[model samples]
Target: MERTLSVLAAYIQPSPYGAEGVSLNHGLHFTGGEPFLNVDLLLKGIELARKFGIPSLFVETNAFWCRDDDDTRSTMRQLKDAGLQGMLVSVNPFILETVPFERTFRAIQIGSEIFDQKLMVYQTDYFMQFSRLGITDRLPLQEYVSRVGLEEATSRIELLPIGRTAYTLGEWYQHYPATTFFRGTCRAELQRNYHNHWDNYGNILPGFCAGIALGNVLEQPRIYEEGLDLEVYPILRILLDTGVRGLCAYAQKRFGYQEREAGYISQCHLCLDIRTHIVRQAQEFRELRPVEFYTQLGRDVPADQD
Candidate 1:
């Protein structure tokens, strides 16, 4: 798999339109359902990355397999030895339901000992009230870290209003008025950061919340050299330029799209609604790529078009 990736990387790097002078040396992150689940593959992938002269390799996991301290220690030792530069353990109320906090705490302890400063915790502020487990106050990240004696390893982030959350957990937070659209910018795209996400199928996305695909790494590189073409992607360009309001206007004018009476929770909610409408109305919107992402937002495309 490494050889295949190298060949693909090589193919794009030298091409006139590919990203030249950029190699795996930038960085690579292994994330998904749970990276630690496939320890062998994870280790081999890291080893291959090192062999290819990649500078850094990181892994993100829910720490579900940290039931045994000795086993966790052994796994962390092996990963560290295989050039795993860092590890991120997800700790929150959602994960705490199935996997006890004790197990996650043990993983953090062992990971910190092995990976040293390279170990960190990734957390979100959206914690549901799991009455069965008596988890009411959300996972107190700082308190938990203090208890574990690793207060410096915790990083909290805001929950993005995308995917299932846009429909399910969206009501938990207050949304901006529809008139406030276009007041914000997409920091991820503007920053053009090196950290990119790749799913199991190798689809490279700009960010976790932004479902816009830059093309699959396993295949030819589309935005490798020149970067994403906002103009080519009409939806994204409008969103970037005019924000969700612009897209809403475009949808209304182009496809006669309608807005909900309740308004939107955020720009993401409005964007998803427009995309969902376009997807259901015409097949041409497939140019957006990763059509399944917009279609799976829990809202169905209407059968009839006006």
Candidate 2:
């Protein structure tokens, strides 16, 4: 916490969005394998952020622990007391298989009572859920929305074509032509530079899916003074200038990266595949940090696994 504060104090500048009621100059978020898995620690972090005068504290949870209404309400009350301002509940097909929708519904009911409009539901590409689950288009959208009590006005988050999603779910989506695939710019990278994501180990990433590491929080002064130079990070610079295909070609020439004959589903799919290949073959690329972010295929584990 001290290291992060020092880094923010030294390097971060207030942007236009930092106006009084607009957004926090520094915000803290707790996300993970499941934040509510360690509710005690989650509460402590929120309390610490409040102590530091950090304006916004949010948590993203699968709501797997929201098994019973009374238990769920009790847990949320504790978090709200500890300065938790918002809760992002994961309500989608992946979590639905193990956690009943009713559990999430109960959570939303309790959360709305506490956080009001601050409570929100996040789902990854609702249309893709149909493809994965074999649900037909004739299925009314309200049928799914009614289950969660979320209206159409709720936000929709796109599933990035990275990690396991790239390998498994990417195949299900129709691919764009090669020329068009590389044309998209990374809006996440360009938009928010003030806020960064700090992992459990203090590794700071520019964005969640962006594999490039600015540096670890423990080395605060040096990294802050030097700042994050996109030019120093070869892959990020190439991605900004040439997009995904340029990165594919760079990886092929420098690291002997191989591409699938079927091509990529999106720019992120190609970028992730290149990073996965680089990180696996060479230790130097470990500077990208949080190796698991680039390597772990999400959720679809083999049945033979323990």
Candidate 3:
């Protein structure tokens, strides 16, 4: 954790793009499946970031563990005291399906009091809609949609057509054959500097592209010191040079991979499906680190299915 923060602290600088870089604010944000699950580790991370003078430190959570006022307040205060600048409570239908709405409401209510303007609700739209519904307990997403109307719900939600959503929510989207999205390369996405993530295992996830590891901070601490080399990452090179289509072709030839006849919702979906196949085949690709991501997704649903 310290090494990753150290490297990140030295790497990021004040944006020279001025107002254009507003969305690309350089900050260390702690997020996960849910950061609050391990309060001790979360506090330690905040302290380490502060020790390195990393500004705008914050944590994002689903508030699944915010069971009561006292525990919630204590944990929020503890994080603040440990150098957390802000908190974002996730308020969406998916989270509301598993975590009670009361917990999210409590988190936002208490977090606002604690962090003030720094307490951000990721999708205030859903929060407001859910609030209007007067739901206090956990509700299934289908129930929420049934009440709100599918079109209305779909229009309001910012559902990214990637990861598990590509499978679970595929019915709502138009599916295209793998070759349909072969127009562009992944150079821009792979080379993106802003909003990238370094996972717990020190694997650098460029452009929030999970499962794809640019390099490990622990193994190749200075991997990107001189910029990315295509030669070093042959798989990444194919992705950059020819996009998911190239990757599809390579995987098909090498691993006897097959594209879904049912098709994909987006290039990312296709890419994920292909990568998941590669991971399941036990093929070793250094760029495809954190194999558990694929395993977990596979456990959830078959990536190749629509």
Candidate 4:
């Protein structure tokens, strides 16, 4: 994990987006299932970013650990002293569905006091809306949608119709044939300099296309410098040349993958479903990484795994 961060820091150049809102284009931002879940690791990463001179360093969280005033204050102080520049607190209808609003409220309240202007509330608009709605604790997504109306609820969320979202929220979105989402090749998304992620498992997830790996940094440390060989990353090469439609075709012929009868919500939705099917089949594809993603999504697989 430390080596991956070091390698990434060397290649990650500062961009104009650095001055903008909390975009990953800026620099090393620790994110997670929840960064606060492992405080020691989070602190180590923050300190390492500082050591490597990585700019715009911060950590994102769902604020589930803001249990009390003392805990929040102590943790924030410890992180600040460890060289964390700021923090982003995530809030949305989906987060509210499970995480109590009081926890988020406490995070914002204490975060402002500690990090001051450096603290960012992602989608601060939603925070305001929840506050205005008198949401004090946990609220189901359906109930929130019902209270605010579907259109309004949809407008407030910064949702991407991929992963489990496409399946769980498909009812609220328009579905189209897989071909309809084949807007263009994925070369741009795969090669873009922004919003890339290198997980602890060493998989490089470009453009937040989780479950798909451009390559593993730990195994191919020179990937960023030498570039990926198309032959080595066949799945990535397919997406790079022909887009999701091509992937769908390839999966169909090679893995007997069938398109969902119900259709898809977005190009990413189709891509994720195809990749999930391929992972379930257990045919080795270097790009379909972190097989645990499929398991977490309720897909069955052979017992022994990564």
RMSD values, in order shown: 7.7, 6.7, 2.8, 3.6
Candidate 3 segments whose C-alpha is farther than 4 A from its true place = 13-25, 303-306
Q: Which pairs clash (backbone N, Cα, C closer than 3 Å) in model 3?
A: none
Task: Count clashing residue pairs in model 1.
Answer: 0
- Residue-wise lDDT of candidate 2 within 237-287, one digit each (tens)? 676677777877888899887666566677666666667677766746534
Per-prediction TM-score, please?
Answer: 0.72, 0.74, 0.92, 0.92
- Please report, as a residue range, the 10-residue window in candidate 2 with the lowest summed lDDT: 297-306
lDDT of residue 277 for candidate 2: 70
**Per-residue accuracy of model 4 over 1-306 as CA lDDT, tens digit each:** 678887777776553446222444576788878888899999888888777767777789999999899999999999999988788899898899888999999999999998887788987888999999999899998899899998888776677777787877778899988779877898888888777888899999887688888888899888877888889879998998999979999989998888777777888888888888787777488888888777787543222221
Q: How does model 3 fare in lDDT?
A: 0.83
Instruction: Give candidate 4 misplaced runs (Cα > 4 Å).
Output: 14-24, 299-306
Summing lDDT over every window of 10 consecutive residues in candidate 3, give the lowest-scoring window.
15-24
Compute the lDDT of residue 244 as modeled in candidate 1. Answer: 73
Candidate with maximal lDDT: 3
What do the candidate models score in CA lDDT, each in turn?
A: 0.61, 0.63, 0.83, 0.82
C-alpha lDDT of residue 232 in model 1: 57
lDDT by residue (tens digit), candidate 3, 1-306: 888888778765533433112122466688997887788888889888878877667788999989999999998898888778788888889999999999999999999999887788878899999999999999998998899998888797787888888888889799998889998998898887688888989898987577898878878777767666668778899998899989999999987888898988999998988888888887578889888887788865664443
Error of 4 at 230 (Å): 0.9
Candidate 1 to native Cα RMSD, angstroms: 7.7
